[model samples]
Target: MASSRGGGSQQVIRTGDMEKMSLDQLKAVKEQADIEVNLLQDSLNNIRAATGRLENASAALHDLSLRPQGKKMLVPLTASLYVPGTLDDADKVLVDVGTGYFVEKTMAEGKDYCERKINLLKSNFDQLIEVASKKKTLADEAGLILQAKLKQSSPSS
Candidate 1:
């Protein structure tokens, strides 16, 4: 098969010649496909985690915006510590804009920001899933081709 290369380069590999190739060449194609699938899977996993976080953040922002001002609540200073505090101004909140940067925003504004972030993350997750699916299909196809070549070379029918 002819494959296009970068910089106007062209590579011509005849699939008919697979039977003539050494065992190593067939194995190499399978190995390369496996690596591609693995890398894409890792990227998909990370995107999934980010998507979950954005979903949770958006939900929390929405819930916080519904509370009354000066409502008594336990503020979480850490994952395990919840200090007694009150919502001095339910209409105001601190939002992390990313990269360790934060800004004060009204509760409504914060909810909007979280929603936007969630939408962007969802889009990214969809794109990543598509790519990962394609990579996995490629890997499976390569493995099948390799198996066929091996059977063709074997003495047994």
Candidate 2:
């Protein structure tokens, strides 16, 4: 077996000719690799869950935006001002309960939910970034240790 050297340099290692590594060195390398892999997996899972919530929130917002807002009402109430095309079909008119209210309550609720989802996604992203940084540091350290071991095992040229 063969492996490339650190920093994408020209050096290479031929494992077959290398002397056997000590038990402690092997165990240390294994532990470092395991930590990096576990952190990466956790980051992946967090991003996946955050993305799902974002997609759901975005879909709800889109659906709300497409709702029809111009339709005449069959039953006219004196207190409410009926705005034509408020409902999806011709049967329902948009009714304003006295005070020039243009707010879509459902849409408002959806926006709130979307905001919350976005905050959660941002938090997850930050966590993933932190984890990724730690993984990189550990991986770099492991690579250095492994390279040192390989050099020690190699015949002095």
lDDT of 2 by residue, 1-157 (tens): 0121112342322333222546475556547556655656666676677667667656745654665556343333443753433455422223222377643445556566556766776675666566556545655555666678778779999
Cα TM-score of candidate 1:
0.77
Residues 1-157, candidate 1, lDDT per residue (tens digit)?
0121111242333455544667788677557656755675676677678768767877877787788888898997766999999888877888878798989998778888877877876776676566556555655665666788778878985
RMSD of model 2 against the true structure: 14.8
Top candidate on TM-score is 1
Model 2 vs. true fold: TM: 0.48
lDDT of 2: 0.53
> After TM-score superposition, what is the CA distance of residue 98 in candidate 1 from its true location, in Å?
2.6
User: What global local distance difference test value does model 1 have?
Assistant: 0.68
Local error of candidate 2 at 133, Å?
1.5
